[model samples]
Target chain A: MDLTPLFLPQSVAVIGVSSSNDRHPANVIFSKNLLRYPVRTHAVNPKGGVLHGEKVFPSVSAVPEEVDLAVVAVRAEYVGSVLQECIAAGVKSAIVISGGFSESGRDDLQTGLVDLAARHDFPFVGPNCLGLYSPGIIDTFFLPAERMVQPPKGGVAIVSQSGGILVDLLVKFADEGVGISCAISIGNKAIIRERQLLEFLASDSRTGVIVFYVEGFARDEGRDFVRMARDCGKPVIVMKAGKTNEGGRAVSSHTASLAGDYQVFRSVLKQHGVIEARNEYELASYCEALSCYSDKSIEGRIGIVTGSGGHGAMAVDACISKGLSVPGFSESIRQQLQDGFSASIRSIAAVGNPVDLTGSALENDFVSAVETLSITPEIDCILLLLLPYLPGISSDLGASISQVYRRSGKPLVAYVPHVEKYRMLIEGFELNRVPVASSIESAVNMTSVLRRCRPC
Target chain B: MLKKEIQNILDSSREVGWVLEPNAKSLLHMAGLPVPRYGWAENIEEAASMAAEIGYPIAAKVVSPAVVHKTEVQGVSLGIDSQEKLQEFYRKMSILPEFAGILVEEMVEGEELIVGATIDYQFGPTVLFGIGGTAVEVYKDVALRMAPLAPEDMSSMLQELKGGKLLAGYRGKEPIKFSALTEVLLSFSDLLMDIAPFIESIDLNPLLCSAQGCVVADARIILADQ
Candidate 1:
């Protein structure tokens, strides 16, 4: 059995809560977020009581509740005794967040924790780590994220070894209005590692796409994780770092990790069906698309609709970069676009595959071109390029895209520059059960990644 | 064949090794190899007179168990045309603290090749044969085959190297009898196959290729006798 209770805890006990400067950083912040979660929380501290208006029990056993997960924030040297109390209290899941374990090359304390964990069959999160936050279960991250973090619900689940990278990715997604099912920061993996997590996530219904940021991988461990994801038939994208020798050595020093032969890692990833991402943004956008539209089939071609000629060219380049074809319209469809577009729109567009809907194009003009493209049995998908700064846009772009989205089984994904204007458009697509995106890269990545993961 | 002879040496006296280079080559010559004619000497007078008796324009080199590659330490002198040069050569070679004795020999001329046999810890005894003049190791154009290899295998191993092109009359050169070189490689292979357990390394470097036949010019055999 997996120690998922460690991450998906219904009742939690925060072991070292305090308002003072010295008590760990995660404790002070998580103490407030825990109040929002529907959980029986036991705040353990002898000196402080009623933190976040919750009673502070001296120890976990005295809390008089079934503690599924225990977050220990005591001193590094005193963590072993805290774990001993957790084991006695029948705490099946424990997240050890304080640093200075085996990662510091201190042998004895690390060994003690490992032995203590094994006898009781408890899984650990980290000795130096930012904890898990599963948005699917409303398990928000403990890092004062409430003020800025708007959790978007979709298919993507991310597991990062670096906590800093995890937070940074979340912020990036928030900036783009892209959401995730779960974001996990598994630092200094004292007990749980990528392999076990991959196997467990294979059975999870909430997670459709799994993205990871890796600096290094141990010989057999990372290979096993890839194979598990492949067998589960989920798209796994990795932003594998350390492509150079010096970068590889740095990866080793950072994680105390053995960076296996890079070619071997590449070979295994290919054989087991994992996609290597180009960067963090693409990695997130790729998984976001996969998780959102895991069932859709992007046959072979795309129709581009843009406000300017430059955006049209950029969209064509994006399609070509993704190895997707921009199949042209039939002669009748081209004439229909010529008839639908005004004189100003007709002068700029050569009426090719990337039909540049020139400036002054209105909501009716957008609707007419899409109606023409979608009705054609020739086109497979539509890449709707919307510039919020453009004129004659119906404040109802969200409703218009949703109508086109449902009328044709072909997917409609958009790229918007104005975040405020497109927020409701994104929500409108979600309401109509049509997949939408915020960035052009995200749109391209999502299409390619989803098409690859759920192939023809 | 040479295989049966080496088998007799290993079976009879496998413990106490014939340790030094000269002693080991004497054992090889006794085992039916055409080793170079040489006389072992102690002092300068004996070495020079031995070189004179063997004839002028001879070679004088130290024979030592401690010294492995003579050229590495400048331990050998070739073409001693006079008694003075021979004595001087003896003075430099014999006085080395590591040197065991001096070998005064008549220098023979023709083509030269190296033949070796090594027992691999994993694949067992292996034989190697290739070009050998002055820079054999530096120009590592060689071929190897598993030991106890057949005569045909030895011929094929020779054909495996680009250096073996010389044995076939390279660039307007007189071919050093192909049959003779093949015989030397096969015999070396037989030697390794027969000795098996007790033998660790064998080197017959500069196996001179003459108009008549191929003869062993110098040899060093290391025995793991313990």
Candidate 2:
């Protein structure tokens, strides 16, 4: 199925909009899209009243405009009729934002929605979800626009099982300057799930990396998903919940007992070349790095350049523990790096695997070290642990290093503390396409995950 | 392709619901996997002759549907080096409930390892390789992959094990032929895939490995409940 209509819908009808309550989820979605997004928005309610100065059609078919998608936010019992009206009206797709389905112990109702959608050959996002947010195209999330921070538009597409987690990630992505192309909340997944969305996003021209926040998979669903990811031609990162053996099934063999759900899920993900994020931080770190550098070729070899020797040591330790190599610089490269540095700090600088240009080193020294490392054939990537608090380092160092990064065409990542004062420095690197992490550990994680996902 | 011999063994053991050691070993042997030379005996006279023919220091295991773990029931007697000892094992074990017969097999020793397969709920037919013995549960050092094993998966699974280095000649021990071990795992993978629909799980525990190659020292096949 072509998912273009679901994601890039030009016209949307918001069903269940209430004229009496502007705070209703359906009203919130209608006003958010009509006021901000580019998609043509229509409101639908049984009362046939005015909402936000627009005529509210009594049903979907009453809308005179051609509707590509319908955002259903009615009560659980009314969702079936609302969806039927959408199918009869020939709407291309729907996103059911209502909650009372399988998650509420109403499997029969959820199954009814599935059968209704299947019989009509229709596709929808959820029976209980916040729905999708395709930047500039449409926004179906019921959360009011002013309350949530919108992430900048870019390559990473997130498909999550929990809407709360999706909203949290959006806030995080916005705060971290991690650009996102879309965010989909697939609660209950009564009609569409991760596997289908993964296939869609893999072929999406706008999506460079795909991330999934999975709680569990149905029978054989995970296998089919990972197998598709093996050749999806895009980087797929998954952060799974329910890793513990709290609900393990009774089995009779060592293999079965040892094959805990998480263990098996993790193993399958690794075997199929999917990056498994162990925690939320890794998820964001990986998505941030991969969103920026998935197109670059990155071997596991890293060359660390830091203003503080302690940061360099920590970075080297983190790199080695993650199975990434911090190969020692060749004598000639070290000599060249030293030649580029001023005598004030060159004599005391440590020019080994992780070159430490001490606190006294100026911005020129850091940029020169990064430049030298970027051209070195032995170094597959560079990790710059920038300490903005240092005396000689200027804020323009981010811009200076980014210039070298662009000229050398080598992948570079920066570790800048996420302080308000250093926003300019972080933005300078990020705007020039170099990913910046808030912590040294996240910086190393970004480089390592980028290397692991280089093939896709 | 599944061997007809394995099919017949599975077919005959249908009523029992699980394949016993001797028949499991026969299934492995027929599938071209290396198993210790063995024979089944229903009587003391037959057990004595089979032990003599297979040579001394043989292991005798009880073949009964009701007894899954023979060692726990004191139904396993190792180092039965004499005809009298074999008769004594039969006399003692025959009194146990559901005592069907004795499986007489040549005793072999080497580094212990395990290869197993189970039909996972989601992935279906996953294979495991790791350190094996009575401590298989205690150590819990294993690596798993979806079956119909990939060429690279075999070595990667071995590499993932904590005791993988032990297989490459630990200390003064000679390393077992890796190609031989790979062939056995691949054949076992094929057999598991072929029988996955009918079986719940299978185990080739304590597969003794040395310079001579690998052997299935013990085997267990659990058929799916009807």
Docking quality class, candidate 1: incorrect
Pairs clashing in candidate 2?
none
Candidate 2 global lDDT: 0.88
lDDT of 1 by residue, B67-94 (tens): 6567777877778899988777777776
Deviation from native of the Cα of residue A28 in model 2, angstroms: 0.4
Runs in model 2 with CA error above 4 Å?
B1-5, B11-14
Candidate 2 local lDDT, A19-138, one digit each (tens): 778899999999999999888899998999888789999999999988899999999998998888898999999999999888889998889899999998899989889999988888
Q: How many clashing pairs per prediction, in order?
A: 0, 0
In model 2, the Cα lDDT at residue A454 comes to: 46
What overall lDDT, based on C-alpha atoms, would model 1 receive against the true structure?
Answer: 0.69
Q: Rate the local accuracy (lDDT) of all candidates.
A: 0.69, 0.88
Residue-level lDDT tens digits of model 2 in B71-147: 78888888888999999998888888888899999998888899888887788888888898867878989888887
